[model samples]
Each structure stands twice: as C-alpha cells, then as structure tokens.
Target chain A: MHVLIIGAAGMVGRKLLDRIAHEDGVLGGEVTRLTLVDVVEPTAPGPLDAITRSLALDLSDAGAAAQLIAERPDIIFHLAAIVSGEAEADFEKGYRVNLDGTRALFDAIRAEGLKEPYRPRVIFASSVAVFGAPFPEKIGDEFFTTPLTSYGTQKAIAELLLADYSRRGIFDGIGIRLPTICVRPGKPNKAASGFFSNILREPLAGQEAVLPVEEDVLHWFASPRSAAGFFVHAATLDLEKVGLRRNLTMPGLSATVRDEIAALERVAGAKAVRLIRREPDETIRRIVAGWPRDFDARRAAELGFKAETRFDDIIRAHIEDELGGKI
Target chain B: MHVLIIGAAGMVGRKLLDRIAHEDGVLGGEVTRLTLVDVVEPTAPGPLDAITRSLALDLSDAGAAAQLIAERPDIIFHLAAIVSGEAEADFEKGYRVNLDGTRALFDAIRAEGLKEPYRPRVIFASSVAVFGAPFPEKIGDEFFTTPLTSYGTQKAIAELLLADYSRRGIFDGIGIRLPTICVRPGKPNKAASGFFSNILREPLAGQEAVLPVEEDVLHWFASPRSAAGFFVHAATLDLEKVGLRRNLTMPGLSATVRDEIAALERVAGAKAVRLIRREPDETIRRIVAGWPRDFDARRAAELGFKAETRFDDIIRAHIEDELGGKI
Candidate 1:
C-alpha cells in the first residue's frame, strides 16, 4: 500500500520512515510507494521494494494542501507541526502553520472525496500537551483538553477536526497523543523541556548535562522506537472499535528524574549518572510544573499500542538504537 | 459605552438589544453608540438614549470582519451562528459561518490590537452542545468539550480561541456556553431539540405542540432573559478572577419532561398541558439522548450569573415576558 508521511524529516518521522523501510511493510501490507513530505525536502531512504517520492512543501501555503491530497496515498501520517516553543513565541506563524495548515489538509481531503469515493487511513501525530495545568494525577482518556500554550491549543483543535472529519467519513482518521520521547537522539536545543532529554541523552553520550528540576518530579515518556510503533499500529487498528471518539492518549512510562538517574546508573554505572549536574532553573521548573505528570492511557494499552513501563528499558532501548549497543 | 452586537437580529440578540435599550445603559455605563450587525439588515430599535447603527454584514465574507472591528466598539457581543440542524446539513456553510467567521472576527480584533492598544470586550455566544455524549451525572466546570456535532465542534474550537486570545491580552474575550434556551419564543423549527421548548411554549400560546420524547427525558435549560443576563454579566464581570479559562457553562435548571409538564399545569392549568400531543420520534430521541442532562455550574453561579431553577419559574417567565401577566 502507498504511504505518505508529512514532517518526515523530524526525529520521530525519520524513525517512522526507517521502521517502514526496514520492516518491509506495516499494517500487514507492503509499502509499495512512500511519499515523504516536509517544509524542506525530506531525504528519501535507499531504494527499497517500493517506489519513493520526496517533496518539499509548506502546508500553510494556499493550494499546498490540495496538491498534497491530490496524490491520494492509501495511508497518510501527518506529523508536521511548529514545535511548542516556536509556536508560543511566534503567535501568528504558529496559528497559521499549526491550526490553518492542519485544517487545510483536512479540507483538501474532503474536497478530494467529493470528486470521487476515496477514504484514506489518516494517522495524526498529536501530543499530550493538549492537556494543561490542574490535571488529575492520572489523566484518563475522557479528560478534556485545555492547553496552556498556543501549540497545545492548536493540537487540541486539530484533534477535534480529525475526529469530526473521520465521523463524517471524509477519511478514516486516528489521532495518537504521544508522550515525550525520552532520550531524543540529538543535541539539546533551547526548549525548556530539552533538559528532560539532555540529562539522559548527554549522560549516555559521556557528556555533561544539567538537571533542571527536582529528581522527584514525574513526567510521562516513551522511547523513539515505541513512538514509531504507535503510528504503525494506528494505521492498522480497527477504528470501528474506537467508536465515535478518534483521539487517544498513547501509553508511556511515567518516570521521574530520579528514576532516570537510577536507570542510567543501572545501565551505564555511576560515572554516567555523575554527568548530570543539579542546576535548578526556576523558570523551567515552573513551566514543567504545569505539565501533566502521568496519564491513564488504558485505552491505548488495550488497543495493541505498547510502551516501555520501566525507565531501564527506555534507557536500554536508547542505547541499543542510538549508540549501536555500546553505552 | 459603545456596544457592538454581531448577531443583533437573532432571538437572544434582539432580547439583549431590548434589555440595553430599556435599561438606558449596560455595564453601569450609558450606551453612547450601538452598532448591530447580521447577514440580513437588523431593524434599528425605536429611539433609545443611545445612537443605534444596524448593518447587514456577513462575518465570513472577506474584509467584513476587519471593517466591523475597525469601529472598535467598547463591548462586542458576538451571538451569530448557524443552528445545529443547518450546520449538520451543510458542512461547508457551517465551517464557513461558525468556524471561519469567528476566527476572522478574532483575527481582525488582533490586527486592531496591533495597530493600537485596542482591546475590546468580546462576549461570544457559545452553546452547551460543546459537551457531547457519555457525560457525567452533572458536567462540571472542568469537564472537557467533546462535541458530537459539527456545530458543537465549531463552538468548542471558538471557545479555545477565546481563551487563548484572552490569555494573550489581544482581546478581553469571554465565551458563555448557554444551555438550551427553554420556551424559545416564536415558531417551532424542525430541530431535534425543539420539543424541549415547544411542549411548554406552544401550549402556553394556546397552540398544540408535539412531544417527541418520553416524559423521563431530562435536559438542561435557561430562559431567553437569563441568556441575555449572562452576556451582560460577562461584559461587566471582573475577568481577572476568571483566570486563564474564559469559557463558562451558565447555571440552568435541569429537569425531566414531566417537570416541564407539571410546571405548565401549575401555571397554565391542565387544560393548557393537554394541548401537548404525544408522538414519539426515535430519531429525535436518539439525538436528544446524547445531550447533557445536567450541569454543576457552580463556577458560573459563584460569578453571579443567575437562572431559574424550578421549571414552574421558567413557565412563569415565558408567560410574564411573552404573553403578558394576563396569560
């Protein structure tokens, strides 16, 4: 089956691409054609059994969404978004890209469907940011979305559109609200949440990283490997069983900084743990405080979407995938 | 104070206009200039203490929002919307009028803010339809909005935008999620929820009305006068106390159909109650079944928004307001 991946250049997107390219297929179907899309031209993988097409496209631009939908791939993975920090900083650009861009894509698919009978499996990569402050200890599937940031608000709106459009039979849609991908395989950026990954990723790479918040502060997480698995599972899941609500919170390990340190020590010894400097930044601490600490992702867990419950497993997965098993 | 009414031609809007005209002012200030807008020309009320301007302008049309915002009224009442049944029938029109129109007005206000420190009080007319099926015994203030219908989805999205904009300080906005206005005056339309008002309204008007659902069917409601009061209170309330969340579910009476009938009998006698014809409609029953039966509107009540709790008071209100005391 033909598959389209928007924002195919991001870390999770690349991982998803790798999974499809290496696994030979997904959802019990061979990836006969791969369409990779991003604002910048995404690097296409090596020639596989399937045909490969890569395109540089900005969804916010007029007619861009229609052009993208014109291809009509059987399965479309929309992961494109302006990051939280960026969206918050640039209000106009954030709403333009995140809200309008996403809506344009949905409208385009509807326009396409009007021309002929076509129902594609549309898998949207949503975020846990949809829930804001004053959250319950374990946010249930039924909890309402009240995003604190513009980026979160945009995602919430997009999720609403996905559910509505899916209900209308415009497309078979499923929105996966992914937890933060622990040990993001890259250099630490300026994001406040960057410290979560930096402390772990840098220590594993034998580098120093600042521990921004208290060790006991808990947050939800999943490995990069598991993030890819969610999109793959979403494309194949029996949505009829999902009933009217299409969006779901994916299962993830709810761990604290101390847990991460303990896991690091277990996997890479105290030497790696020593690399984490206890430097508290009140700004980051305050920002993180409002974030959801954990969720009752029972629906996702029951629906074949899996995640590492133990932070040790998360660390091991990171080492195995990013460091080639040499920590 | 300059007051701008976007849907000045609507039932609630006309009531609001009447309220302001008769009150001689609103929010403790004299209504110096009143600008009324709707798709069709709204009839200017008879001479009031304030100057009135009624214009026919569709908010979804290009430049219409900016032009409306250009006037920059001190308090803007946005009550315009396509009803639920119509929104369900015409998808494009719904999005265009409900979603895009609302956004355009907001963007225009934001643009106005950019030019100068112009922040208008934007009071949006949202609906309880924002909350969909599988509700709690009484939906609380914290309950998330997951509207089952396209109309509900649009209102929910608009509520998000309202909060975000209010938080950003671009516009001081408030969204009042009014309950089903019981005893809606005038003719009964083909809406599934029409019976909620019809059984009480038509019988009081000495006209027979059909009862589509069982007597045990419970629902939430507020009077047209109370809906108007909510907007007025929203305009003048200390929004800083509202915090970041600007949307609120107004307090209303939650009663079963039997409660309505008994109240009708109490006010208009059994002879008036007998004007109701029993004709069960499965389609409407299924639709009404998904509606919210009750709400814990504690927050709104705390904020000084009031509504009738007894179904008898509701009937008396309709009779006193619509039929004069003689009825």
Candidate 2:
C-alpha cells in the first residue's frame, strides 16, 4: 500500500516510519510506496525497498495542499501543527497554520473526490488539549470539547471538519486525540506540559531535573511507542465500527508526579528518584491546573486500541525503545 | 443605541424590528440608527423616527460583510442562514453562506477592532440542530455539539468561532440556539420541522393542514415573538455573567404533537382542530426522529431569557401576536 506521512520528521512520525520499515507487511498490506512530507525536507527513515518521495511544503500556502492531495496516496497521516505556547502567544500564526492549514487540506481532499471515485484513509494526530479545565473526574466519550487555548480550539475545529468531510464521503478519515507522550525523547523544550516528561527523562539519564508541580498533581500519558501503535491500529480498523463520530480520545495511563518517581525508582535506582528537585512556578501551576487529568476512553479501548496502563510500563517502553534497554 | 440586522426580512428579524420600534427605548438606550439587510430588499417593519437604511446584499458576496461592519452598529443581530433542508441539499452553498459568511463578518469585526477600539455586541441566530441523536432525556448546556446535518455543523462551527473571538477581545458575541419556531407565520416551506408549525398554523386559520409525524413525536419549540426576545435579551446582557460558553440553547417549551392539538382545541375549539389532517411523511418522520426533543436550558433561564412553558401558552402567544388578539 502507498502511504503519505505529513510531519514525518517529528519524533512520533519518525517512530511510525521506523515501525513501518520493520513490519513491512503492516497496514493490512505490504508497504510498496511512501510520500513523506514536512515543513523542512524529511529524510527517509532508512533503506526503502519501494518507491519513495519527500517534499517540504507548507499546507497553508495556496495550492500547496492541493498539490499534495493530487498524489492520492492510499493512506495519509497528518501530524503537523503549532504547539500550545506558540499558538496561545501568536494568535494569527496559530489560526493560519493549525486551523486554516488543516481546513485547506480537508477541502483539497473533497475537491479531489469530485474528480473521481477517490477515497483515502486520513489519520489526523489530534491532542487531548481539546478538553479544558473544569472537567469531570473522568471525561467520558460524549464529553464536550471546550478548549481554553487557541491550539486546542483549532484541533477541535479541525476534528469537526474531519467528521463532516468523512460523512460527505470525501475521504475515510479518523482523528486520534493523543494523550501526552510521557518520557518524550530529546532535550526539554518550551511546552508548558514538557515538565511532565522532563522530570522522568532527565532523572532516568542521571541528570537533575526540576519538578515544577506538586507530586499529587495527576495527568494522563502514553509512551511514544503506544502513540505509534494507535496510528497503526486506526489505519487498519474497520471504519464502519467508528460510525459517524470520526474523532476519538485514545486510551492513556492516568498517573501522578509521585507515580513517575516510583516508576523511575523501580526501573533505574533510588538514586535516580533523588535527582528530581522540588521547585514551584506559579504560572506553570496555574496553566497545569486547567488541564485534563483523566479520561474514560471506553470506545477506543473497545475498538482494540491500547496504551500503557502503568507509569512503570511507560518508562520500560522508553528504555527499551530509546535507551538500548539499559539504565 | 445603533442596531444592525443581517436578516431583517425573516420572521424573527421583522418581529425584532417591530419590537425595537414599539419599545422605543429598548436595548438599554434610545433607538437612534437602524441598518437592515437581506438577500432581497427588506421592507420597513414599522415607522422609524430614527435614521434607518435598508439594503439587498448577500453576506457571502465579497466586501458585503466589510461594508456592513464599517458602519459599526453598536449592536448587531446576525440571523441570516440557508434553512436546514436547503443547506443539506446544497453543500457548497451551505458552507459558503452559513460558514464563510459568518466568518467573514467576524473577520471584519476583528479588522475593525484593529483599526480602533470598536467591539460590537453580535447576537447570532444558531439552532438546536447543533445537537444530534443519542442524547439524554434533557440535553444540558454542557452537551457536546455533534451536528447530524451540514446546517447543524455550520452553526456549531460558527459558535466555536464566536467563543474564540470573544475570548480574544475582538468582539462581544453570543449565539442563541433557537428551537423550532412553532406557529411560524406564512406559508409552509421545505424545512423538515416545518410540519410542527403547519399542523397548527394552517388549522388555526380555518384551513386543512397535514400532520406528517406520529402524535407521540415530541420536540422543542418557541414562538417567533419569543425568538425575537432572545435576541433583545442577548444584546445587552452582561457578558461577564455568560463567562466563556458564548453559545446557549434558548429556553423553549417541550411537547408532543398531541399536546399541540389539545392546546389548539382549548384555544380555538375543535372546529379549528378538525381542520388538521393526518398524512404521515416517511422522509420527514425519519428526519424528525433524529432531532432533539428537549433541552435543560438552565443557564439561559438563570440569565433571564424566558419562553412559554406549555403548548397552550405558545398557541395563545401566536394568537395574541399574529392574530391581533383574535382567533
């Protein structure tokens, strides 16, 4: 099967590519052709024994999305987006890239369908930020999307467009609202929620990291491997089972800061847990206070999507996948 | 206060015009200027002592929204839309009018705000069609908007845009999700829900009207007068009280077909009720089945937006308002 991956250079996208290269026969067929795209030229994951092409394109630019859709890959994965802090700070850029860019792609797909009987499976990487604060103990499948930031609002709007386009038979589409990727690889960046991964990742690598929030503050997570697994499952699943609601919240592990310390202690050593320094940042605390901590993703679970149920499992997966299975 | 009405020729819009003219000092200030617009020429609802202008302009046309916003009416009422049946049949036109037109107006407001400090009160005419099936007995303010039709999806998207723009301080906006306007004035149109009014409206005027659905079919409703009142209340209500959820399901009476028939008998005797004919329409029945039957509009009610609580009261409102206090 031919496949196209947007934002293919990002961590999860790269991991997904690596999985495809190894599995070969996954996605319900053999991987015969690949079209990888990103804002910057994305290098092929590894040796490709099939037809392959790479393009650096901005979807928000006029005619760019149409050019991409014209290729008509059998399956397409869209993962490009501006992060939360940038979106909140720069409103115009956020709407231009996140909202307008996404809509342009969907509209391009619909226009393509007008030419012939062409329908491709589209997998969008959505985020749990679609749900804001003042939530219930466990946000259910039917919970409303009331995003507090510009990024979440953009995702929620794109999710609506995805459902509408799918209903109109333009494309077979699905939006996976991914949980926060715990133990995110690479150095910590500017995302407010980056600390959730930082404290565990740095300490596990024998580097001291600041614990910005209290240990009792709970949040949801899934490892990068589990995140990739969700895309694989979504691409192959029977869309008839998904029904009219095309967007779904992927199942994730709900844990607290203390849970991370416990898991790190179990995986590495007591010395690793002691590397976390307690520090209180009021702005970060206020922002984190408005985030969703738990979700009842029964629909996704019943549909055979799985994620790490324990924080320790998440740490183990990170170690096995990124750390050569050693401390 | 200067006021602008986007669909001033429609049922609720005309009533609103009449209300403003008669109330004299409605909208918390004396009526000073009126700018009325519709796709066709809109007739003056009543004598206007204040300066008024009427125009025949489609909002989707380039520069039309900008021209309207340039005048900068202190309070703007946006009631223009392609009805549900038309929007479902013509997808392109639906998005062009319902989605693009709405966004064009919002962008115009944002641009106006950029030029100077000008933020107008924008009251949008949304619909309960934003809610799909599989709902609880009484849909709440927090219910997710998963529209079953193109029209509903467009309205839901507009509601999201309204909230985001309000949060950004570009404009003060409120979206009122109107229920089916029972006893709607004039001839029956193609709206699937039109029969809910036809069965009562025609029969009350001593004419035969068909009932397309079962007597047990329950639905939510408010009179055209009540719908106009929702806009009036929305125009001046303190924005702080509304908080962040800018869209509201307006309060309306929930009753079955039988309840409407009984109300007609009590208000105008069986002679009027006898004019009703039963002719089940399979298409309309299937469509109506997916609609919301009731809503728990507690927030709207708490904010002092009132509507008839019983079918008898709704019928009386029609008679008193439309029939000039006579049956």
Candidate 3:
C-alpha cells in the first residue's frame, strides 16, 4: 500500500513516520510507496529512505491539492495546519491556509474520483481547541464546538467538510481530536500552554523551568507516542463502524499541575521537582483558565484507541521516547 | 435603518416584509430605505414602494455579494438558500450557493469594512437541519451538530463562520436555526417533509391532502409568522448578551401528526379534517425518521424569541396570515 503524509515535517508527522518505519512500513498493509509533503521538503528515516519521496508544497496554492491527489495514494494523512497562535494573529492567512487549504484538498479528492474509482482512507489531525471556554467539567463526545479562536473555528469547519465529503463517498475519513502533547520535546516557546510542557521537559533535561499557573490548575494531555498512535489507528480502523459521524475525541490523561509535579518527583527524584520555579503570569493563567480541563472521550476509547491513564505513565513515555529511557 | 432582504421573494421573506409594512417600516428603528434582492425581481409592498429598491441577483455569481455589501445596509437579512431537497440532489450546487455564496457575502462585508468602517447587523436564516438523527428526547443548545445531509452540513458550516466573524467584530451576525415551517403558505409540493404542511394546509383550503408517515410521527415546527418574527427579533437583539455563541436554535412546537389533526379539527370543523387522505409512504417515513423530533430551545426562548406552544395556535396563525381572518 502507498501512504501519503501531509505536513510530514511536523512533530506528530515525524513520529508517525518513525512508527511506520520501525514496524516495517506496515499500517494495516506494507506501505511500499511513501510520499511526505510539507511546506519544506521532509527527510525520511534510514530504513524507509529508498521507497520515500518528499515534496515542498503549500496546499493553499491553486492546483497544489490536485497535484498531490493526482498520485492517488491509498492512505492520506492530512496533518497540515497553521498553528493556533499564528492563525489567531493573522486572520486572512489563517483562513487561507487552514480552512481553504483543507477544503481544496477534499475537493481535489472528489475531482480525482470523478475521473475514476478512487476512495482513499483519509486521517485528519484535529485539535481539542475545537471546544472553547465555559465547557462542562468533563466535555462529552456529543458536546457542541463553539471555538473561541480563529484557528479553532477553522479546524471545526474542516472537520465538518471531512464528514460531509466522507458521507458523499469521496473518501473514507476519520478526524482524531488530539489532546495537548505533554513534555513536548523542544526548546521552550512563548505559547500560553507552553509551560505545561516546559516545566516537565526542561526539568528532565537538568534545566530550570518556570511554572506559570497555580499547582491545582488542570488540563488534558497525551504523550507524543500516543498522538502518533491515534493517526495510525484511525488509518486502519473499519470506518463503517464509525457511521456518519467521522470525528472522534481521543482519550487522554486529565491531570492537574500538582499531579504532574508529583509524577516528576516520583520519576526523576526531588531535584527535578525543585527545578520548577514559581512565577505565575496572569495573562497565561487567564488564557489557561478558559481551556478544557477534562473530557469524556468515551467514543474513541470504545473504538480501541488507547492513552496513558496515569500521569506517571505519561512522564515515563516521554523519557523512553525522547530522553532515550535514561531520565 | 437601511434594511436589505436577500431572498425577498420567499414565503418568510414576504411575511417579514408584510410585517414591516404593517408597522410602517420600523425594525428597531425607522427604516428609511429598503433593498430587496432575489434570483428574480421582488415586488415591494404598496406601503413601502416609494422607499424600496428591488433587484434581481444570484449571490453565488462573482461580484454579486460585493455589490450588495457596497450598499452597506444597516440591517441585512440573508434568507437566500437552495432548499434542502434540491441541495441534497445536487452536491456542487449546494456548496456553491449555500456555502460559497454565504462566505462571499461575509468576506465582502469584511472587505468593505477594511476600506471604510461598515459593520452591518447580519441576521442569517439557518435551519434545524443542522442536527441529524438519534437525538436526545430534546436536543439542547449545547448539542453538537452532526448533520446527515449536504444541506445541513452547509448550514452548520455557515453558522460556524457567522460566529467567528461576529467574534472578530467584522459584523454583528446572528444565525437563527429555524424549525420546519408548518402550514407553509403555498401550493402543495413533492418535498419529503412537505406533508407536514400539506396535510394541514390543503385540508384547510377545502382540498384533499395525503398523509404520508404514521399519525404518531412527531416533528418540530413553527408558523411562517413566527419564522419571520424570529429574523426580525434577531435583527434588533443586543448581541452583547449573546456573547460569542452567535447561532441559536429557535423555539418551536414539537407535535405529532395526531396533534396536528386534532388542532385542525379544533380550528376548522371536522369536515375540514375529513379532507385528509391516509396513504403511507415508506420512503418518506425512512427519510423523516432521521430528522430531529424535539428540541430544548430554552436559550432561544430566554432570549425573547417566541413560538406558539399549542398546535391550534399554529393553525390559527396560518388562517390569520394566509387566509382571511374568517376561516
């Protein structure tokens, strides 16, 4: 089987590619032909290099999506998107890239099918940002999407298009709404939610990190491995079971900052816990307050999608995956 | 206030125009100018003819929405859409008109604002079709939209865009998700859901009407008068109170075919009810089974949007509005 990964240079995309390579390029079938797409050309893993082709392409450009669809890969993973902060700051660019880009891709698929019988399995990367402020204590799978930001609105619109296109038999589609990836492996950024990962990742790297919210502040999380796993699972799942509602919220650990600290201390000793410096920024606190703290993602869980139930397991996964199991 | 009605030739649009004309052209403020637009030219009421301008235009045509926005009508009532059955039958036409046309109008407004500050009060006519089957006993305001048809998907997407644009302050927009208009003032048509109105309408007009689904089949409805009133109210309401969730499911009476028949008997004599013929249609029954039956529209009710509580009142509305005062 041939597999196409859009936004393959991104973190989750890279992780998904790694998983496929480690498993001998089998995602339900042997992925003999691999196509990686991003705004910049992506590099393939050593094992899969010979069979891989990388392209630098922008989906928003006219005819870009049709060019990609012309190849007709059996499975398509669409992970391309303008980040939340960027989308919110630049409205035109956000809509052009996030909303218009996704729609173009779907329309291109339909156009391709019209020429011949072609229905690829499409796995879309959605975000929990689709759920905005004033959420229920635990947001259920059936809760409404009233996004507070432009980025979230774009994602919600794309999810709707995915369902409609899928129902029309243009493609077999599934949208996986991922929780925030905790202990994101990279240098700290200025995003309001960055502290959730910075405090843990930095401390594990023997560096000090700032804690910007109260210890009791809660949020949902999954490890990077689990994020990649969601896309892989969605690609292979029998979508007839999903019916008309193609989008599913993936299960994740719902924990507080206090719980995260406790887990850090348990895994890396008190020294790592002491590395977290208290410096609460009111703006970040206010922004974080509006985010969803928990979710009842029962539908995805019932469909055999798995996640770490314990904060300790999440921390351990980060260590094993990013820290080479030596944290 | 300069008011513009995009689909001025439709039933609810005509009702709204009648209401405005009856009240001497005042919707929250004195209406100094009126602009009516439709695919074909709309005739203005005698009372407002001097102040009204009618135009024939299709919103999906290039530059059509921009031309409408160029006028900068203070209150814009967007009621244009391809009806459900037509939209479902033609996928491309549905998206082009229902989705692209709506977006073009919105983007046109934003572009106008960029050139010069012009923020119009946009009251969009959305539909309850946004909700699909397997609903709760009564779908609440927070229930997610998982539409089972292309038309519904387009409406849901338009609603999302409405909310996001309002959030950005490009325009003050409100999407009213109207229930199926019952006792719809027109000749009987072959729409799957047409029987909901035909049974009541044709019988009252001294003609026989076929009853498709079973008597126990329940559905949500509002009178054409109430539908017009909902748009007028949305045009004037303080959106600050509504916050960022700009879309609302309007209040409606949820009744069964038995309830409608009972009401017909009450309003008109049993002789009028006797004009109904029973011919069950399996295809219509299957189609109607997937529609939303009831809604807990408390939020809309609390927001001062009112609909009849009794089916008798609904029939009376049809009599008073469509027929002479004396039935």
DockQ of each: 0.74, 0.73, 0.92
Off by over 4 Å in 2: none
True-structure lDDT of candidate 2: 0.90
Among these predictions, the greatest lDDT belongs to 3
Checking candidate 3 for backbone clashes, the offending pairs are none
Residue B148 lDDT (model 1): 90
Q: Pick the candidate with the highest TM-score.
A: 3
DockQ of predicted candidate 1: 0.74
**Candidate 1 residues B1-327, lDDT tens each?**
888899999999988887887775566688888888998988756865348888898999999999988988899999999999999899999999999999999999999889988999999999999988889999998887878999999999999998888888989999999999988999998888889899988988789999999999999999998998999899899999888878999999999999999988988899999999999999999998999999999999999999998988888888888888667
In the range B2-75, model 3's lDDT, one tens digit per residue, is 99999999998999999898985347988989999999999888989999999999999999999989989999
Candidate 2's residue-wise lDDT over B1-327, tens digit each?
A: 778899988999998988888886678898788899999978765577347899999999999999999988899999999988889889999999999999999999998888988999999999998888878999998888888888989998898889888888889999999988988999977777888888888888888988888999999999988998999999879999998888999999999999999999998899988998889899989988899999999999999999988888888888888888887
Cα deviation at A225, candidate 2, in Å, is 0.9
Q: In model 1, what lDDT does residue A15 have?
A: 87
Clashes of each: 0, 0, 0
TM-score, predicted candidate 2 vs. hidden true structure: 0.98
In model 1, the runs with Cα more than 4 Å from the true position are A47-50, B47-50
Name the lDDT value of residue A270 in candidate 1: 93
Candidate with better DockQ, 1 vs 3: 3
